[model samples]
Target: MAHIRSRKHAAAPQPAHTALALAALTMPMTLLAQQAAPAAAGAEATLPEVKARAAAETPYKADAVASPKFTQPLVDTPQTITVIKKEILQQQAATSLTEALRNTPGITMQLGENGNTTTGDSIFMRGFDTTNSIFVDGIRDLGNISRDVFNIEQVEVVKGPSGSDNGRGASSGYVNLVSKTAAREAFGNASIALGDASRVRATVDLNRPLDIALPGSAVRLNVMAQDFGVPGRDEVKAKRWGFAPSLAIGLGTPTRTYLNYLYIDQKNRPDGGVSTFGLPAYNFGANTPGAAVDPKNYYGSRSDFDDVTLHMFTARIEHDFGRGTVLRNTTRLGHTEQDFVLTGVNAVTATAADPASWTVARSRQARHQTNEILTNQTNLNTEFATGGVSHSLSTGFELIHERQNQVNAQTLTNTTLPASLQQAVANLYRPNIDDAFLMPPFKGAYAKGSTLSAAVYAFDTLKLSDAWLLNAGLRWEKFHTETNGATFTAATATLPESLVQNAPLSLTDNLLSWKLGAVFKPTADGSVYVTVSNAYQPPGGANHALSTSATNQASPSLEPQEGSNLEVGTKWDLLGGRLAATAAVYRSENRNELVSDGATPASFSQVGRRRIDGVELALVGQLTPAFNLSAGLAYMDPKIVRGVPGATGNQGGAIVYSPKVTFSSWATYKLAFGMTLGGGVRYVDPVVRNSNLNNATSANLPGTESYTVADAMLAYEVTKNVNLQLNVYNLFDRQYVAAVNNGGSRYVPGQPRNVLLTANVAF
Candidate 1:
């Protein structure tokens, strides 16, 4: 672990007027105490009065306390925002980004290839994939790659359509990762962790004064490294190491600037696992555990891969002109490159009885991506008595550009013998197998695409006679995209003769998206809000045409997918804001729906429309002073209202992957002597694969079962600067699948029960 140390500078205490305003809002009880003071011998009581005044004037304060004024109030935001504080992450001994997010409601994670570096980890929110909308410190880091969680301050999940503030692509919601920043006081901490699967990790955070000889300049550094050993289930192994360093320069009076950089390198080797389509749907009946093969031999010898590198950088400047007027400018850049190779079992010979005789086909894929973003946000807000009405305004501008490049290749060996015979000979003479067989390389394909977006939005809140407050907002956006790609089959000897050809394709789209909303606050602690928002997505390379479409050509001249959502929600704070709860009902309609048939991978078309109606309830904050609780429940019914010819049933049921019921809850208790203990449980109902049209044979396909998982953690403070923690994940050791591929043979299972121990020291 690295060590961080920084000099301390104490700013002058706030002026008397500002202090009075804060006291009026936060400690009205102080005024009551003053009013209740007994009228007595004033001359003799003068000394006590003076002492009380002096106590209020004391400037000394705890260095680690969080100021209420600096923290944003949850009630002020219209959307549902959940925050996972740094203290919680440490107490939970969160070893990965996914684990940290699992504690949040309405979020689910799917591990890639036994949690290997080469596999792409995916997150889903509200039934929509979230790979393209992740953010770091309010900047978009949109790429199909894994993100490292180090030097993180907190994770905020903003629910519902956030286009008004976050620009486009936020149809479901957005995740914001706040990075650690230089503290104004001296502080440093280091921690080491060891866990199951031979996992070892070390992390350090340090804040140091840049100019101890001068004043007002500081630098902060954070670094993390982890090595995950091979899992007991297979021969897979993964390792990742990364660092984040930042520098802050305090310009003379009211201006500050900062620069930060991130570098991460990860590598892994994955043994061949079961394919989704190669296995039976039901694993509980008539199937012996590990019956297909010895659990030890499940990993084939030819499977291997690696993820090269990922890099990111960001810089920003903030200026305060005075009196609630501020301006902020920021820029961010990121790049990723990956190369991987895997041995796949030929589908033609993938039979249960002859599974051992299945031949292996080698393949490789390489991908590169880059993203750049620029934003200028200005807020001119003021509160004053104007005709007995007070108003507050917020507005901003944002621009973003993202691009991606991908190349893929595959090859097969023609041994001119039965797969069983080939496997036997290859095992006996491994070295001579390559020489005796004819290798035909599969021609590679490339894809290039880009997205450019710009938006300007504004929202205002007007206090109507104190009791009723009115809120309104509007956003306008322009989005454009272009993509071109080609596939070549020249590398294979049988391709040209068998009608295989190289073809090039291109696509482009430009459109506008907008949103509007209003809220009525009847009381300080309760409010009702309604919103109408429109979102759009331009068809890109990934959703482009393939050879299997009915016409043998891509859908001609695709249009932008558009949606409008109407929502009504209520928020309330109970027990002096210690307990918060929200309930919302929404109806969203989508046009130009992207629909695909299971008959062929490329059989995709745009349907007329679809609609989804749902309700959500969530609660957070403290149930009592000693017990903290968080929970969420959701119900959704999504269905297609229109259908095209040859398409399946449209209005019978909800869409695929949209489970009707989901619930999560967590509770923690504070104990004596700086110790805390907690536990949580999560449950999700089974989801159908093809909800619109279900066949009995396919109905038996594995739906995510309704299962419960439990986690617990214990933390003890050894000293002012030292603490220790122990965490147990999946306490019940339940075996369940997280996701299944189309073929039903490949199932991604949830992690087994695991334990981690951590020690931390701070100064």
Candidate 2:
């Protein structure tokens, strides 16, 4: 836990609006020096209205990708894609989705995972666990919440084994999110940020072009409001509100229809972080007391909370069946509801040599979750030819009907522990505990379920020779799980005796998933690829429970965790085409996995395999029109070479948070007058909290000690419609430890420097 201390003594001074935030970096560098533009040169005949006005102001990278449902290009997508537009999350004044995925890198961010519910949003990519692979415009988005990029307009990631694009995902990557539709032209924007513990946020967007009821209709609206916090943890908080509305209906006409809706409401304050037994000023005595704490100490419970509600509705219909055939149909209907009363600690095992005579146990979880989904996807794109080759087909069908409900309860809010303790401990720098304790009633419903999926898919790119290309795809699904209910008599002595519900259980599966790729294109801006994919995950995990095993009642059949990915990549489009570079090398595996049953200890068996080999590099867009970049780097090596045998899987451990290296970069320029400055640096190594792949027994579990973290930004265009930005997060205020609890007791820190100041206003 303690391994950072120099960004000039971390943080504590500076603010006086830091000289009005360095004078708003000077009105966007005097409007980029009065709209520079003077260097003359060659021009032989290359006009398509100046390449369509440089692709409409090139908002930094993203030349294609509509979820491999076809819109390829990202240099002909073979695999490995990243994209996070929305002007790089408003130049990093990011608002969630893990700060816009830290601008591309081998994603990692564990934060919570002690009990199945760890207060939402967890991540780990490349080395696996994309926390259910997320997605929005592309559907999915089931449980474990926390997402918001206001109304996002970009955030793709994709990467590997997308079994032909999402059906059970993330053999190594997935994260789609693209919303903010409806547009003919009309516009409006708004923003507000301001940060530092009392962080506040506001956002708004509006668009309209509706001629009322018909005539090239259009409508859009987005809204968000926040009251954020969590810099150094303490009374961590977050208050949220969201809304998105969209509508569109024929504009250029060929039959189009869209109507989207989203809504979110969140209430926060849940951060049970800090504590690592013996950190930095290590002093392992009383069995392993801890010290050097204070990354904003806040031992959970201040009336711990979490309440969320999300809503979604989508409808899309496009019809173009003319020569290039097209037919789309999308229909979504979502709902999510979460309730919480978190507060978990437990990580003190007798030991109290000092560190205020250690002790510190705390628990009080209570939950109520709900999710509902009703999807319907239908697609058909076309182009055909045969012998001379030319394919580009795409076919799809999807139908889902999901339902899930869960309720967990527990109370033992440590009234300073004693009554046979469910959580009792105190004194880790000050004893006593009680935050108006009283929060355990949420019985009813232990877990409910329903799942029905039916899918069909097809894809083909072919084109085979004008520079060879040959993607392929396949998909087939048919799952049907049931379990209308399951109970635990409300909490029989800390439950988890391996639930047993032999009545009302049902299961079924089919899954077929597949993918293949090849691209060559040596010129349209370069590409070179090779891909292979497959994915699965059937057995009732995302809610379709089957329970049954309270000491084995003939229920032990769970299957479906297959996975695959094999990649090789290259993408170019250098300078002349406005930057973009990429490289990849991958290998991922997961033959079944889900081991742990060397004679049933909570039973689980799937033959485990787990692997991950990687290499990646990237650089994106506009290296010049006044610079604009986004970088990435990776090196993963997740392991578990075989079946389980302790020490975290087999071949020596190492998957936990899986970080063998990761990097994130950010760049911005437009210097001289439209002022913009940028900075970026993020490194992450040292991980292995448990999943053994033995990094030499990861110093007794609880890993995460490498750190870099830095960020900066400044913008000004104070009047191109008003703009002003400031950003800066952890600009080296690195305290490091962001998640680790393989017994090192608790953690989750990493956030210090902090600073944000925005004011955008568009029109």
Candidate 3:
């Protein structure tokens, strides 16, 4: 068993706590006494031996997911799922959700569109966009702002088509972030860290059982504050603070209720990325090489800023009945508002004869946006027997309303600016930070959209025999969406025009998703399974936005896109159930993609198809009493199955931002006398982002090259209540491009070597 750390309650002491602390302090003597006593001749084994089993549980592995919809444990679950527990986050000093996600493979980051930067977590997984598929405790969380992990319990990533698990979503799957809640336990913990580039962060988690009329009631509060600078970059800053408070009633009784509230505020300076003039695989035409720009250059204006405010309220109740039956209901209201003014770079304007006169054209981008959601869900879990078979079943129904409102800004992209606005053209080698430019005007253009959905789903796992099991799930949903917007219009000589109002657009759709799987267990600790699943993505399903253009994918008249996945996998529990190993081979496809119709008017059709075949291997949990490890590797082959004939964009071409291989691993080992050593490595294969199908194989195309990054950590326990840790990122300081825009004109460079020291305290 792994070593256990004593937990001291901040509230009134209990008998169990005292006994556990005493037993830990005198383990050697207690073990000898147990050997001498021999359980008192089978007189109902007393509590003396309970402390042995009370040792702290391993944090590297989890047996079951927190969601009640999963009817089986991770070892028996017939899907590709990865869970990232909070302990791992603490050891790595990861403060953001995106940073923590580096533990998994086959996931890549992305820069924004042409001449812009994508806000929040712009993630690409399994060759598909997953930005809209993020959830918080089973409820869709929509926004373009970044997320903090201070109040999170664990992050669960469900791979493959999981439409049966949630409503309409990405074909690649979704990410669910579980929150921390109050329990019938009392403890207090806090941490403070300081890192390079003027980084500082602190957080506190406190939980205590109430001594009020409700015997099992408890309360928990988690708070965080941070101010940091982006490594290897100048004039960039991130500042944020947030808190989560939870209350629970009847925690240990037949009836339970929980209430939680969250609030966060942020003020940050967004990065516009450095110019990509001098990078590898880049040229100045006719096979002429270009000079690389400084990676640490800050091309954005000092006044550019992004501010956000968020609020969320949730309530849940559960009831348990005899004979293994339970019911639960959850409701949530969430809202987020963001306001940002950013600067972006386009292609460079070079003067070959005079390199010092080269300049890069700049543009302005801004948005005032808000996202809101209201949802309620009810679920039931029951276990029963029918003749010779046993069944574990889960059924649920959900009602959701989601909305997004955005105010557009008119960017000043004209190159014929007066000398007073010369800041729009920045010097390629030596830029002036004090240069000034006027903010673009807004002509009162705005867009507002909403989606309303009702869904019912059921999942069941039937145990046919000791070595055989069958799992099936089905979901049916009905949805309606509406989008309304207005834009400024220019007047002609014959008529006068002003703001033009577009008619309200509406769409309605009914969707059905299902999955089936069979498992065969050859031994008590191993299982082999094969599964097939399906998902659907209707028009305006992700963002609740519709378009009138016939060629647009979000047009209300278009049909829904369809996705399917097939997999054969195996799972094993070794090292006395302390370690888990899994391997899977999967084939996933998405059809009904929008493509050129090849007609006179140049319309579009939904006949395009894309496919990806991949193999994944993973290992997680404790390798020995003093060692812990988590690792994963993925190999992918993505192709365009059907597309517009001879089109350079998709015809028999590779998808953008999709890599062929990726790997990530992290491990930690305890040394003698309260010391630990840890390290990790991450690798991403080269990715092509160019639209020209024929140029996909060319070296000069706009894309990111393969890169590897390494990190290390060391920790030492100061006393029973305090410990110190230090983490070093980019151990080798390798220079590489982390992400590139589709236009390939700009790129976000990898971070340089940096260090952080943290102190943790518990009482």
Candidate 4:
């Protein structure tokens, strides 16, 4: 069938109420500014008293790690960035990367076809699924696979399209996992944890300066390993094991080098049985027996997968030329190879009555990826007097190259009904038990898909007089992509045919992206800013598909997706910078929008425009002298302006898997005798199923109901060098589906309540 696609153009204008709302949000900042004057004066008047208070409070040093050099205060950043620290992950006893992300607002997950082990990790951010943009440390770790969290120091989520800095990725956002690094001081820490799911984990981090006898350098290493046996209902079980090791060396005074490697292997059974027949819309019920089948005997088979191994090497050098000028260069290279085998019954065509006629399929896949990147950044970053005004300039150039190869082979077998189902059916026909059907090898490969991007960017932050801070930046990027591979169709009676083709396709494009903003900081702890930015993504190999036209049309040429965002926000600190809050309202419009049609399998056409408007509120800081809290609430309204002609009228609503509202909060309080207690709650709004459809004939699946989850943890200090912690996830034992397929054939249920105990020793 020929695909139908159309394009639309619309100019999104901000509403008056939106401006008013933004204005109101700034009142707190203004109020805080007005209050700071008197407090500073009072401190000066009572210098002795202030000094005495500072001395007394200095005894209780905070455990929070200082932000890295590249990181600025949250309020000072031009864009939204959420940082999840190592302490938070340890305190919560997070098992997987997904569990850790759940605490962050405006993020969601969609399950893969297989179970958690082999079923790749699919994540959504800001209403879009672009998991390929995920990064390890500072380099890209593209592909569809479960990411390991061991030896990770923190995770940073940079909201909004990061194409300028992250190359081609999700137009919505990107996630960066920062690996643990050696410390300058001598220190060592180790932890062991046991959880209710039969989960066991151990990690150790140590850093020691090189002996004085060694030549001008320091070396350190970190290592971690974990094994988990997950317990599930109905005879389902999942297991995983992994390890990571890293080494770092500092050369001279201004140069550093690091090397790291990771290896993970996992084997597990499917979480639940796949449905044999399609179910009705809005069926949130449990799995049950279908016609001609016994639910008791139907289950999925075990699968084994491994991330195999990954190697990364990096070098950084910094040079300071006096006179407030510095130049820094960073280079990185990474390589990864993965292999796995997945086994499962074809749910699309299976029944208990004809159990003997059931068909089982097994697939083996391998992937190899490599990346080389270099960045040179120079900063004058100094204030200078010009025309009685202060000016600051920063510039940088980055070049990146990434290439990957993916291969897969599948085999299927069909057999007659088993003795257990002989009475249920009179006649059953099965495919021949030939060698071809037993383990027929159907192989396909995607080879030499590579991307190269080069960017030169500069920005200036000018103190235009004392009342206003004006910032503007522009980035010019050139991107090229090439892919050479073959496409294969699914098997029918036997192994489907592979269309052998190797037509190398390449595309080059140059685009300019820019950001402009103005911030007015009336006082040290208050500021209001308004910004406008433009971002774009070049078409890539993923968009390639087969065409029936003669001469084998190969991959079609598509226009790039472009977006513009407008935002206004205000930030404030109350109670002497101890409590902070921020509120923002933004609207984004996209051109040459990409939309998925459920009818066409795996075909994505760039057509129809869309827009999204949302409001976000965040608060982080101490609620009282002995208590701390962090919370976020977000509301989004997204709509489609145009869809396939004659299909749906301005089909606009919540994007698939994108909830309308989300809320998350956490609080921690100090207890007696060097102890602390903490807990958090999270809520996701109901999703509107089939909300993108235009006609009544299309299935209008009801949206999933909203759900709330709670988690708590308790910790006590055993000694200066030892500590113990206990954490409980899903405190209420809430049972709900985490994700559902469009046809409702495969559903992923949320994990059950789990408890973990951990002990840590530091020296």
What lDDT is reached at residue 376 by model 3? 73
Let me know the TM-score candidate 2 reaches against the reference structure.
Answer: 0.32
**In candidate 4, what are the lDDT values of residues 10-83, reduced to their tens digit?**
11110000112122333443344335434433433443321112112211111121212122245544565566
Cα lDDT tens digits for candidate 3, 1-763? 2212211111111000011112233344334433432332233232233253432357788766777777887778889889898999999999988988899898988888885587788888888888888988878898887899998888888899889998788878889888888878899999999999999999999999999997479989999999999889988889999998888876655456677888899999998888888787775553235588888888878788999999888877665542446667777778899998888877677756677888878887788999998777878888888999988888999999999998877775546356566868888877766778667666556889999999999999899999999999999999999999998765689877677888889999899999999999998778999999989999988778899888889999999998889999999988888899999999999999999755566667899898989999999999999999999999999888877656545677777788999999889999999999999999999998864576544333368889999999999999989999999999999998888887777888899999999999998
Ranking by TM-score: 3, 1, 4, 2
TM-score of 4: 0.77
TM-score list, all predictions: 0.77, 0.32, 0.91, 0.77
Off by over 4 Å in 4: 1-72, 113-118, 213-217, 231-298, 322-324, 343-385, 411-442, 487-499, 541-556, 594-606, 645-650, 688-691, 694-703
Model 4, CA-based lDDT: 0.55
Give the C-alpha miss distance for residue 40 in model 1, angstroms. 47
Give lDDT: candidate 4, residue 572: 75
Better of 2 and 4 by TM-score: 4
Tens-digit lDDT track of model 1 for 660-745: 77787677787999897888887877655544454224422444566788888887889988888888878998766565543333
Q: Name the regions of candidate 2 deviating beyond 4 angstroms.
A: 1-109, 112-122, 129-146, 149-171, 180-209, 212-214, 220-234, 243-252, 255-321, 325-356, 359-382, 388-390, 393-459, 462-651, 657-763
Looking at candidate 2, the ten consecutive residues that score lowest on lDDT are 8-17
Best-matching candidate per lDDT: 3
2 or 4, greater by lDDT: 2
Clashing pairs in 4: 292-352, 292-353, 293-352, 356-416, 356-417, 640-652, 648-694
